[model samples]
Target: MASTPGILTHWPWEPLGNFKYVLVAPFAVHSLYLFAVGAEDWNLTYLLTFPFMLWRMIHNQLWISYSRYRTAKGNNLIVDRSIDFEQVDRERNWDDQILLMGILFYAVHWGVDVVAKIPFWRADGLLLTFLIHIGPVEFLYYWFHRALHHHYLYSRYHSHHHSSIVTEPITSVIHPFGEHIVYFILFAIPMVITALITRTGSIVSVSIYVTYIDLMNNMGHCNFEVIPKWAFTVFPPLKYLMYTPSFHSLHHTQFRTNYSLFMPFYDYIYGTMDKSTDTLYETSLKKPEDVPEAVHLTHLTTPESVYQLRLGFAGLASKPLTSKWYLWLMWPVTLWSMISAWIYGRTFIIERNTFKKIKAQSWVVPRYRIHYRLQWQREAINKLIEEAILEAEEKGIKVMSLGLLNQGEHFNRNGEIYLERHPKLKMKVIDGSSLAVAVVLNSIPVGTSQVLFRGCLSKVAYSVVSALCHKGIQVTSIKKAEYEKLKKSLTTQDSSNLALSEKGYNQKVWLVGEDLTEIEQSKASKGTIMIPFSQFPPKKTRKDCFYLNTPSLVAPKSFGNLHACENWLPRRVISAWRVAGIVHALEGWNVHECGDRVFDVDKIWEASLQHGFRPSGLIPA
Candidate 1:
């Protein structure tokens, strides 16, 4: 089995690593200088740092993209290249949109600032303004930042940021443009509103605050740690009141706590801060559990049953298992046995419930046996099933199917049953013993989902499960024997001396009807046209094929005129009628009128090719 990617690893102790110290030092020095001298100039700061920030952000994205490409190309790297760039780009665009919106707001603020010409407000006549602004600005920043992580939006947007579990400086600003815009707007809003309303605006103070935030953000994402051990103890409840690298690191590591960035006060007040900060480092130092309880339970049993077993065991072991007498050994033995029995009983219950659920969901539909000897035909069947499921979902119908037994159950243990019971999904198992039945049942349009898995159930079961899952159907697994029988039937022929390859026999057929103009045909053939058909065309196309302009008389006659053209046309066609595109089109024009009872062109062509059907100029070499 492939090892889980390191990017998924969660370590708590040394969260921000060395970067935290690096960020704090510069920030502290700059802040002190500003405080002591009351410096007014910010141009030097912006000129020196903004370009670096932009460069770091771009460099990080390029590295990530390159890493992904290399991994896909089969190169080894420090990190797994499973990051989805398309998703990242989408998220980044959203962030950019938000950022642009924020810039607009900033423009409005600029106008207000000029019109009001507010005097700078300070706590100590001049300094108090800076402190007061920092507090509320940081507070608002934390609140909006926390809101972004809410479940409603995390999967689609914030997940991209979390994709880089191991933070790098570049990854810090790689948020979707929308999120960046929102952050900018929120960060500026407090300061802008205060300055406008109170007639006290300090460019120097706001610039300091923004610079501090930027440094802090970079430090939080820095892969190194810089904060000294003594600072936690010496800085007046620093560990509890102020944000540190470790605190921010915890936010990424756990993903559910430590939302505050500049301070821990808000998180503590809201009861969102994890109380195990000191223990986090210890936990990281300890050897990882050989078998995490969650993983084991998901693989072996349902959570409900696991919980019940624990409850029963606690009930049984409450008294002293070992006492200072003969009762000591006897009581301990009794308690252990009771606990074991409870565990065993719980497993049995889980298995039983699983089976019951499978049985309850089973239904039969009319199915046609797919000749599996033909690979293309089989693919056609799979494609049809995929489209049908999508169509059903669009029409508000729930399609259900059995999943791969072992893995399906494993996922269930992981608390991922939404796939099984999505609004447009459901699944049931056929008797576990009959793979043939399962496969046959799958082809029928029984619910809105029009596919099933039967033969070679154990071998192809996972494929079927994945396919159905991709189409949003819940799947379950049936018995092995049934799948085996189905497989044998699919491979065997009733006629003698008819040994067919699986791909040749099992290939599926699709009837595509299109009213193609000459340009449309050319474009479609070039794969540039997006037709109304639910199915997209495969990347490869038949070579040397000529377009036939024959009128197809297929019923449900919405398909205007059908055209049939063939590649590898014979060289010695004696007449003009035979070579003419119009005549050739007319030859097979009426085939579509037969509905689903059409002849197998691929099989017929294969037979003809074997029997010496030769083309002069059209043969694809």
Candidate 2:
């Protein structure tokens, strides 16, 4: 699903409008029943129970409708998240559900003739009903709910409820009829047991208890926080007693914790409370605008790696060993993913915002499995990237960085094609390698004597080495021919007192090459740093070694227990930082000549037939 909509201050009516009249339908029926039969006769109290069932349905529907409406407007009480509108559209059968519920509820109530009057003022029946309902119902439901999560039961029945990962109120009741039957028995058990044991027949007491349970159930699935942070702060002990919207949301999302019915006390007692529950709850309450914007970045991911992540996710959904048949069944899904990856693929926004309220939204450019196949489909992929850029621009994103390989090479080669196609779009597109080089330079410590610049043959690498050498820092390279060319350029240009060499001058090693297996093998200790141009991680890497990885289409494999790259940096974040760097780099350029970034300006002009126009000082040879 896309990101949740901007929070609306006013009450939302779209989702609520679906149930506005439905909620009152039961009340109309209740009114008719009361009008037909006067309160003078207590003998027919059994029939009046159907009206009680109707009232319960109405109240639950109201909570569901209101919660959904609020969440859709982004006025969610807790988490800033949303489900696909498609899920809501597909599950728009609540009218049918309510009719079925009404029939089932009437049958259950009619079959049981246990008559009980209102016990609003009566202490004995009210207290007894509360005790019985809370104790036995909670105990029984907890085990029953946990059992429903078992693989066998879950595949057959419970997965229906789990279908709504981001749930609404009706989602609580969207279960199999068999599970519903089990719940009905559980519900009736407490009331019937309480009535017989106390020798009391107060229908009002049972109604109140049922209403309270229904309210909590709907609230749990509401997907909006109804409890304020201050309540938990002031009380301090209320979290143990009450289940917040976030508390129940974890059950739907993480699928393990917060399994109690009305109270979380049972979850706590059973040691099943999610470890991050409190923190996640409070974090979800923060305003979306308060988070920092993330600059999303991405490169090509191997199909094998992508498939592995898919399999891991599938395993999480089903048991692994016995579910090999399930895996075989998923070949069609995997094939479809391959086909989709060749077309639209998955483009997503990071669900959570940063601390500074910056959300990093991402766009994935589609490609094939192998490199040659990707090359053959380059034009198609470029079209997808262009489409992604246009879409991001429409969504108010000012700039988006291209990935390093396919799209990156395309932009570096035929940037004019993009400019010619989308002439009116204001969104800036850049390859981002220039900014990445600048960031690496700034990160290197001040007093380093000699630095190895691997992969110096490429224009980006050559540009970086030139800049560093011009700054009077010694730079070395492995590629002899490129190193000799750079040495000639520095000597002829009369750059600042430079210590440029062909090889063997390494005091600190900076591995800038796409292939790092050679450097990884040669480096002994202290000075090895990895600035990968591809998605591969450093081999036998140390924890202290510096590694800079741009967010890519495929995540890099983690080395041992350490993460070698800045894996969390988003593509938009890279764009934001790159824009900032361009503003800094523009200082040496002719101010009156252009306002756009050098590479961005290059797209509009065809200065050189072979290498294209190079902005002066920004990409000096």
Best-matching candidate per lDDT: 2
How does candidate 2 fare on TM-score?
0.44
lDDT of 2: 0.51
Summed over model 1, clashes come to 69
2, model 1: CA deviation in Å? 26
Worst-scoring 10-residue span by lDDT in model 1: 291-300
lDDT of each: 0.34, 0.51
lDDT of 2 by residue, 1-621 (tens): 112112221123236644444544664466456657765533334455446655665676566446633543343455454443344443444444444444554554446544333233455777877777668878899899999888767767777678777776767776655676678778777566656656553656666766777777787777666678899889987887678888888898888778888778889999999988888777767634221122233433554333322112321211111223444655775677667665654453222222112233333444533642445666665666566666666766544545444334333251445656777766555554444444445445667656766552444455557667767776766566756676766655534433445445345546466555544435524545555433233343445555654312211121011111122232122222223213322222221111122343222222111111121111100
Error of 1 at 329 (Å): 83
| lDDT digits (tens) for residues 406-503 of candidate 1 | 11222122112333334334221111112211221233233533222222222223323333444544322133454344334332332121122322
Which lDDT value does model 2 have at 553? 21
Residue 308 accuracy (lDDT) in model 1? 18
